[model samples]
Target chain A: MIMKNDIILAGVGGQGILSIAAIIGTAAVSRGLYVKQSEVHGMSQRGGDVQSHLRLSSRPIASDLIPTGAADMIISVEPLEALRYLPWLKKEGWIITNTKPFVNIPNYPPLEEVLATIASKPHHVMIDADEIATEIGSARSANMVILGASTICLDLPFEELEQAIRSVFGKKGEEIVHTNLSALRAGRDFALQHKNQA
Target chain B: MQKMILLGDEAIAQGAIDAGLSGIYAYPGTPSTEITEYIIASKEAKNNGIVANWTANEKTAVETALGMSYAGKRAMACMKHVGLNVAADPFINSAVTGINGGLIVVSADDPSMHSSQNEQDSRFYGKFALLPILEPSNQQEAYDMVHYGFDLSEKYQIPVLFRITTRLAHSRSGIERKAKRAQNEMTLPGDLKQFVLLPAIARRRYKGLLGLQPQLENESENSGWNQYTDGPDKSLGIIAAGLAYNYLLENFPEGNIPYPVLKIGQYPLPRLWVEKIANECETLLVLEEGMPVIEEMLKGYLGNCLNIKGRLDGTLPRDGELNPNLVAVALGGKMIRGEEVPSLVVPRPPSLCAGCPHTDSYLALNEAMKVYGKGRVFSDIGCYTLAALPPLEAINSCVDMGASITMAKGAADAGLVPAVAVIGDSTFTHSGITGLLDAVISKSPITILILDNSTTGMTGGQPSAATGRIAEICKGIGVEEEHIRILKPLRKNHDENVKIIAEELAYPGVSVVIPTRECVQTLNRRMREKFKNKKTE
Candidate 1:
């Protein structure tokens, strides 16, 4: 059977969406998957809501952008950002979003309402990637933690992601790679336990 | 063959490096910036002695590329769609003075206004210059096109216009590489007077350029990039150009679309192929990114009787980029969608970073402008343009690069006293210096705030041309030495900075206040290496 994973990665700009993309993309490439990840650069880098359409397939993929209502999953680091891509998510699509709210706008909705909207989804995983990353002693590893939480929905093996975290962050140092791996496991463990509840 | 996943920009860079490129010049602009950034980061390019310089502006970059071309070596200059306008003088004239070496001018158009002022197509500019244009359908095609483009440029002794949209520029995919060719040795043009475009000489060169049109058209027909595929259905023929071909293919995942499809990756229209397709189908659907250049061409001045459907005929939206669903719906598919976005999710517009120096500088400028009232401040391009939004709402206008200074001068001429112009440091060097010269010549009473964050912050912190040299440049540009105040744009220095700005605004002549600080993002990027070093130790 042909395998395909069309994920929409969403978050506030400067919130490390591209970093998460690097981990997932690196893993996808290692598995001999055809990958097409489109990103937002330039002005949006200054703390704006940014989304990247990441498509990976066993065969050749065409569109860099995933069509409306066709995304397999939306992996976001912020709850509010996760809801913004509702139109792009498939009916039975999985939403793997962090429970933490990145409130940069004055009119940002109440955190409870944002969480409630994400919670209302049939297939979803809400993990506090920030809290988990902080607990792992690397607050900046929140992006990796969120990527880990989405592994349940992703067809790829969990071990592949851990290996990716090492290769992707390996340049920074062994310490970073280790911390990111810890953060990834912390997020994955939480998702496996909460999959049924979600 | 080796394959690596790379963005479209990186593919172009890699393709150039592999295809015997000697130098790459560019001004940092969205989409196009990454092309040069890739070259700068490539260790192979460095070892090969390829020069990648971020020029002061697009114009300088293009001229530098032309100079390298004059020395008989492969050279490339890239810029965003608007940046092309700045580089137009050299870009257009380079065609008249036919090149000796391979020269490719890459312009990345941003459709849908993603990170641009307008979605102007660059193919029209290529057509105007009468140059062969290459638009890649995929990342691999993008990489392949660069090698092909260089050969074509040298074969015809003319510059090739390489156009790509935001999607292709920012999009990443696996690209297969070809064997690397050696860079050209330094040499001179065969003819000594080739570049001198005097009216008499230019007339002869112009004729030569125009004479190459038919051959170029024939070349496009056999280029292999402009593919013609036949399908059983003759009722409708589809014309998918550049990146739109990918979206068209997405709708037909089984590798089958019934209608005959003509994938146009090269330009000059290849009239015979167009006519052949036009004759075969009852109706034509033209799918192209940016404007409907080909569609409009198909519907000539007399308005052909062919039922051509595209952006012009409402088959596709007149504005913005194309997607797979849009192409599907245009092909008579249903409008499929999922859940509506909750109304509670408010707009989270981009703003200055947490420790952004522009935040403090804009705050000080806002406080200084209190007595002068609103609508007096004009801002230019860059991260500082973000200040036009709330809660700072510091600037009033953002038209184009270097427009802030000239617009402020114009406004001050119209009796808007104390008209303040807020321009970024890189932008000041790009086009603002000349505008400042004009202001100083007339002694315009406008106070200018040169927000110096030390890098081109908007395009991801490429090394700035205006770094540490802003004060000296302002002085050199005829600004009164006493009136050019350079201050640190910090929260602690906010009160003093505001006072200085207010004093500058009170001056009867042109006064420049530069609030200098390193961009937070650039600072963070630099510190990461230090952090890594500490960890390793």
Candidate 2:
């Protein structure tokens, strides 16, 4: 059977979710899969909530936007943003999200309450992506960490994703690429460890 | 054919390039800016000697493109839906003047007001101007339609309106490129007086335009972009227009929508297909991305005719962009209800970036205007418009692009002392300059605060026409050189900036205060580029 994955990547503006989408989209295209991505741009980029609907399919994709409650995965760079897109997630959708709260508003919900809301999801993996990236010597690679956690749900070959990170960040230099790869591995390891424990 | 992934805007730009376009003119606006940007970025377009440049506003852009068309070269003008209002005069008149070279005016509509002030549909403009419109359903169609639009425009001797909504404008899909044609040589219209719109000539030209309606409609009927696909069920007929077709097709991934579908991309209504579907199906569902133009047309003025169900009949929403989920429900599919977002997730509205020059400028303006009080300051559109929000509710009015200076002048004329106008540098050039000229001529007691950030900060920092020429333009507009004060908008210079603003506010004549600073975003981008270059060195 041909593989099809409808993913919603969510985050605040400047959270580097577009980079994540680009990396995954490049990977999907390289594997000869049909890819369509719809992104939020313009005024919303000023720290507002943003989400990109990315669809990868072996069959031809009709729409750039994924249908609500049909998305296979919700990968978010921020905890609150992950919950914002619950309406678009399928019943069996996996929520791979970073544990950080990008507190820009005055009345942000308590962190524990936000975590509890995400925890309510049937399949979810929460990780301190920023901490993991920092530990891996690249604090800015938190987006890659979140992407790494999503690999558990994504059906694409892991090696393709690793290669995507290299190509997408190749312009940044060899050091940054190495650091981001390590961050991705750390996030994957954490998810695997938690899943094994459960 | 080489296929490349492109946004709908980029696809249109690429299509125009391949269609032998000689020039593209535009003013940067969301969802539409990328069209011209793509043309400017293309090495092929550059080598082809295409004239792609930002105009003062949509009006100048359209007029310039019209001039290029008069020279017998394919040209395009693009802007947001609201920008159409600014270019409406030239656009409407172009239909009457007709064309020598092919002309396509692209109006990227924002149905949900994504980054726009209003969700006005541009299809109405096309109909109002009595011009054929091409509304593509997908990125590939967006590409292919540009070539068709230019051909239709040339064949009919009328400018064609190409309309797209925000969803299609921003979405990305793989598009197969066509063989590129060479650019047209400079060739003038056969009649020297063709563009001259004297009353008698205009009447004749208007008649000529009115006479072309049949041909335009005939073209739309045979346009291939418009299709009538038969289905098994006759219970419901779907009239899907533009990007709404994608949403409709998305509901039935198997490509087996039971209802007969008439997918419309070209305008003149395609009456033949419409009549066919109306005769075939019992009930009609009109799915359009923008306002219910087609739905209302199908329903007619009376309450009667076919059982038409759409935005007006409440089958779908009256406003906002349509998505697949909404279409699914309309198609009688089960509503896929997912978990509701927690109320704890507060709204995170867009704000000025940290270290934005507008923040410091607003702070200083607020302090300076504290004595005279709030509500006296009028602001224009840009990132600076965000100052109307909390922490710095410095500006009172944000009516339009250049309303700040004019509104402030009117307020001052009505005896409001120290009436201030806060406008960005790019906006100042866009339309604010004319208002300033009005203020200067009347000697209106207004402190026009032109925030010279050296870029159009709101729409992704496109190079502004007023970069180094603001002070010169002010002086040329007859503002006193002594009263034109420029200050650095920064935390450290806050006190000095406030003092300068206060001095301008106290001036009884037209005084200009310019808080000069580079936009933080642009500054960071420059620094990053510089750092990259240094590393390479």
Candidate 3:
């Protein structure tokens, strides 16, 4: 079985991009599948645009980097961050992005236009993951929510992801794990509901 | 075999741990920092009494690791590519001294300047020292090669340079474990003066080292790490060294490249295989990262030049890094590119944190510099270098670690009076103090601003070597005690800080102004950790 998924996880630095990768990467590794995750650390973690290339496959993976125009999907926690990695996406690749705008830069373009551009993609899911997370009582779980929304596009089972959440966040205490799980399920539900919508 | 999903740095650390490393020493640096960090945090290492230390600087780290190796215990020293420059003296000298215990110097290079000032490959440093170089193509190799490298080092009684780039350093993949080896028992060298570099013995040792080159190349050929696989398409021969090998394979997803390929994981060029492929194929494609060391070496006499294609010939861009697409394009294929990034997406450059002390310090410095005009502040490496870009635009130069002080002194000598030098606390100890002494002895009219953030914030808040000692260090360096002023870098103290800065700038002699504050990120992290413990209660 030749199973493979190349994902580009994008967001503003410190938005927990690595945490999301930890969850998915752990899930894939637990299944005894091949996993390669490349991270951006050091200077860029100080509130700059950052991205991680996460590859999962049944067979041994060759490259740590996802080749240009070969990513299976782009899962972004911020709207503008979503469009930053368009070059890495496949022709029919899915783009799952949060609707929130991280306006750190002075000249961040209009949010509506960014959202509309994401909307123009053939396969896209626009989500208010921050709002969904906040409504569920944990604003910090927005990244988990975004990760949850991308699960539909990912080939892994939901139970595998839920187990991954438990293992990755196990040391942080049960409350955080619960809140993040709720955020994840809420995000997954939103994607399930709005996946086919115009 | 046990499996662990590990970053390449972590894999190397684990590899070293399993290979019976008695100690590891390093100064924190991107890509390479995690290697020492992993060992420091390992429970097994603690149980086994393995020593892991964060040294004052790369030079000190290498010397300390060499001391450990001197005791007949396996030791490792790690740092980024440029850090090797700081440790070059000991590193090169160690080659002449030989070793009783295995010594591996791991240099994590940044090929694309991802988190570095420049991209300098460490393999050349290895070759220059006449030592075998191991360049792992992936995480598993990164792990296995540690054992192989240690064996090679002990076998030859010489040091091995293990080079890795930012991608391999930062990327994570599966790594399989080998059986654990016991640490070497303390045993002195058979000769008492083995380490002493007296000219009489040095010539003999140097000759011995020179004699080891062919044997080293033979080891490279026989080592399983270097492989030469034949392909049906002999028209274009490919030499993919280190991580470039992975990219070549990535371009061929089916694992079938239509060319004769030489995979170079261990270097000294793996001469026999190189000559074999060179003789068998028509044209050669050198797909190595960083500079074209292989390509340059291949272009030896122009007599046997077989149309070598790489960075030198512009087949691939001379600068930056090599990805699968770049390799694909070099192989006469079109690179895959999708829609261009929309104009709406502005560049979000990395900046200081919202409550960063560097922000307030740079702000106050900008106000003081208004009187002296601009372009006199020479900033050194650290988070404050981010001030080079932004609303502050406070600094004019950031050349390297601890360059700010010397550069400022040079400018002052050249009649740029009131020249300002901005350096971080950690960097000051790293390389700044001697420059400070130089300024004091010469009595240069330079105002030095040391941004004391109490921690090395750039590389994830490693413990600083200069914590709480900047003032005393300055006073000890012979700067006038009265001129060495410490100010709190905060918004409420902005005007006062600016006043102090201006007054120091007007001083005729050397003056050190320290803006002391805890890094906002470290502070936040501490508070979060404290809160988490409370929650755990």
Residue range B1-537, candidate 2, lDDT tens digits:
536888899999999999999999999999899999999899989988998999999999999999999999999999999999999999999998999899999999998888888899999999999999999999999999998888898888899999998888998888998888887788999999989999999999999988988887788789798899999999999999998898898888788888899999998988888999999999999999989999988877895967998999788999998988888888878778567777888888889999988899889988988897768989988988888887687888887799999999999999998899999999999999889999999999999989998998878889999998899999999999999999998999999999999998899999998889999899999999999899889
Kindly list the per-residue Cα lDDT of model 3 for residues B1-537, writing each as its tens digit.
Answer: 547989999999999999999999999999799999999999999999999999888999988888888899999999999999999999999999999889999999998898999998898899899988999999999999999999999999999999999999999998889999999999988888999999998999999999999999999899988899999988999999999998899988898888999999997878899999999999999999888888989987673547798998899999998999999899998989767798888899998999999999999999999988998999998999999997888899988888999999999999999899999999999999999999999999999999999998999998898898999999988999999999999999999999999999999899999999999888998999999788778
Ranking by lDDT: 3, 1, 2
lDDT digits (tens) for residues A1-198 of candidate 1 = 899999999999878999888888889988989999999988876789899999989999999999998999999999999999999999999999998888788888889988988888899999999999999899998988898888888989888988888888787668888998898888888998886443
List DockQ, one per candidate, in order. 0.88, 0.81, 0.87
User: How high is the lDDT of residue B530 in model 3?
Assistant: 97
As for lDDT, the candidate ahead, 2 or 3, is: 3
Q: Which candidate should be chosen as best, given DockQ against the real structure? A: 1
Q: List the residue pairs that clash in candidate 3.
A: none
Tell me the TM-score of each prediction against the true structure. 0.98, 0.98, 0.99
Q: CAPRI verdict on model 2?
A: high
Q: lDDT (0-100) at residue B54 of candidate 1? A: 96
Q: After superposition, which runs of candidate 2 have C-alpha atoms over 4 Å from their true positions?
A: A195-198
Instruction: Chain A only: give the TM-score of model 1.
Output: 0.97
